[model samples]
Target: MRRAAWGFLTPFLALFALFFVLPLGYALVRSLYAVRRPGLGFGPASVEFAALRNYAAVLADPVFRSALGRIAVLGLVQIPVMLGLAAVLALLLDAGLARAVRWFRLGFFLPYGVPGVIAVLLWANLYVPQVFPLAWTDLLAPPYVLAAIGNIVTWEYVGYNTLILVTALQAVPRSLIEAAAADGAGPWRTAWSVKLPLLRPALVLTATFSIIGTLQLFSEPAVLRTITPAVSAGYTPNLHVYNTIFTDDLPHLGAAQAVLLAAVTFALSIAFLRVTRRWSAA
Candidate 1:
């Protein structure tokens, strides 16, 4: 039976190896070797390796460094804001306040179902400097634009995170809450002393997911570029890699940047796992 199961999965494994693993291996190898074109730069024999020059150039490039820094800042800002709002919304949704629970739950979760590219496009139309009601084009333009972008991200993801936290909240036994209330605890006290602590695992899990997602944020900024001239080609790390590979024909550098981004994400995930382990132990 196990052999049959393995046989059934063989095709999927083979496809994964061919499409994903092989390309990743090729990109890693190519990242260390810059291509050089000889003669008129037109033909086959022209392409040759230039050693680790690509990796060195990518590491030394100011634009690449700036893109990384900008992304780090974006992550720092976005993750906390998104998670906090999600936590609050989750609490509200789980409170069972009224007969409108279904409507509120659906409304909150609706944005998560929207594709990221579509959400960005929707924001683009609304955030137009002249058409926008937020005064994004006036003297207070900078803050307005920042707030607008942040709002779009928060709006899109908060509902998803809320659902996660709400589900976690639901897993908490009702007996604990009743016990707390019997002991003279108020609703806020019960939530703070009983609910929040139990939701720690869920919060950490959501935060780690948010970190990974924020690090890879591309479509939102990319779509915004059509409406806002301030968002440049290298505005984000992913954007930098995209521009390098396709716009400038710097495939080697692009691969290097991608590898580095993947490494950072892996490290972040590992660190998050360690923290979760500690929390679980405590």
Candidate 2:
């Protein structure tokens, strides 16, 4: 029976090892080397081991630092706004506020179902200052660009997060809500004191996913860049890597940046898990 089960799993394991692990290993190896073209006549110059040089170079670069800072600011503003809206929407949906709760739920999540590029294109049209005369003058300003991109992310993701929160809220027993109401607790009080605590796991999960997504944010910004000049080639870490690998023709440096980005993401994920675990235990 064990051997039979192993046989069933073998193909999946083999494919995963070949595609995922091998590519990751290759990227790591590539990150350690620089392709050096010594002779000029299209001859092979060979790969030189860079050790920590590429990492140091990437770390020392101001653009990389700025990109990271931009992403940090975007995440700080985006996640809270998105998740807060999601929580409120979830609460409203769960509180049986409207007869069309199912429609509203589907409507909200529908944006996420849209293709990202198409969504950006649609938003890009409305983002025009002329669309809203009051906001016309400030539409394409530098300060508004980050928020524009953030709004795109929020609009795309809030409903999905809401679904997660709502699902978690659904798991809370009706008896608990009834008991709280019997004790003279208001709806808001019940949500704050009773529901939010139990939904903590879902909240943490959504936050973590949002954090990871924010770190690697690219498509919306890339699409928006065509409309807004404020988003440079290296506006975010992932953008930086994309530019380095494809635009600048420096795949090795891009690989190094990718490795560093992964490390940073892993560290932040670990920190998030630790903090949430402590909060849950307490």
Candidate 3:
């Protein structure tokens, strides 16, 4: 049985190291070197070690700083709103408060099935006045673009989060809920006192996933960039990294930025998990 377990684990371990570990290692190494031209116009470019140069440049960039700030704000607002809606919907479905529960479940989760880029484009048409001709307002306008993107994200994932919570709800022993009802506990009272308390673990998991997703905000703004100048090349950190490498032709600096972004994301995720553990303990 031990040998069989090792056999099952070997393939996953190999793939994880090959795909994740190797790429991360390569990016870290790449961030330490730069392409240097020895002469003003005559020499061929060569790789040279300049360990701190790339990282310093990225850190000094105001746009990169703003990109980080933008996502921070977006996550603050969007994560709670998305999770709250998911909790409400999951409770409604679990209690059979709405008709056609099965159909509604499918309908809620369907947006998540659509590819992210396709969903962004579909929403783009609705928000871009040129395409829809009846768009109520310019959601892609500079001041509103971040909120617009948040709406798209919420629409895509709220259903996914709802289903996760719903599965958690199903795992709950039916007898406990029945006992609560027998004691004349109303739906709201039962949810607040019984169901919500039991949902703590699932809620924490979803919130953590939401935090990671918020930092990974790229494709929506990148897609929107094609339609409007509101999304600059450095609109989001990921987008900035992309344009830095491809558009500005600075792969080493891009790699540095990527590494720093990964570090920030990892740090924030760990902090959140630690805070939640403390909450659970208390």
On TM-score, the candidate that comes out on top is: 3
Across residues 1-282, which tens digit of lDDT does each residue of candidate 1 receive?
999999999999999999878987888887877666667765554345666777778789888788778767777887888998887777777767546877887888999999988998777776665767774454224445445566788889999898899999999999998899899998788777888889898999998888888778788778877777667788778888899999998888799888877778889888988988897898
Weakest lDDT window of 10 consecutive positions for candidate 1 = 138-147
Tens-place lDDT digits, model 3, residues 159-207: 9999999999999999999999999999999999999999999999999
Q: What local lDDT score does residue 157 receive in model 3, on the 0 to 100 scale?
A: 99
Estimate, for each residue in 1-282, the C-alpha lDDT of model 2 and write its tens digit. 999999999999999999867877887899999988766837777889999888998999899999999999999889999999999999889989867999999998999999899988887777777776546665456878888889888999999999999999999999999999999999899989999888888989999999999999999888877878888999999989999999999899898998888888889988999998997788
| Error in Å for residue 282 of model 1 | 5.2
Candidates sorted by TM-score, best first? 3, 2, 1
- Once fitted onto the true fold, the runs of candidate 2 whose alpha carbons sit more than 4 angstroms away are 1-20, 39-44
- Give the Cα error of residue 262 in candidate 2, in Å: 0.7
Candidates in order: C-alpha RMSD to true structure: 3.3, 2.7, 1.8
Q: Which scores greater on lDDT, model 1 or model 3?
A: 3
Q: Is candidate 2 or candidate 3 better by lDDT?
A: 3
The lDDT per prediction is 0.80, 0.89, 0.93
Error of model 2, residue 149, in angstroms: 0.5
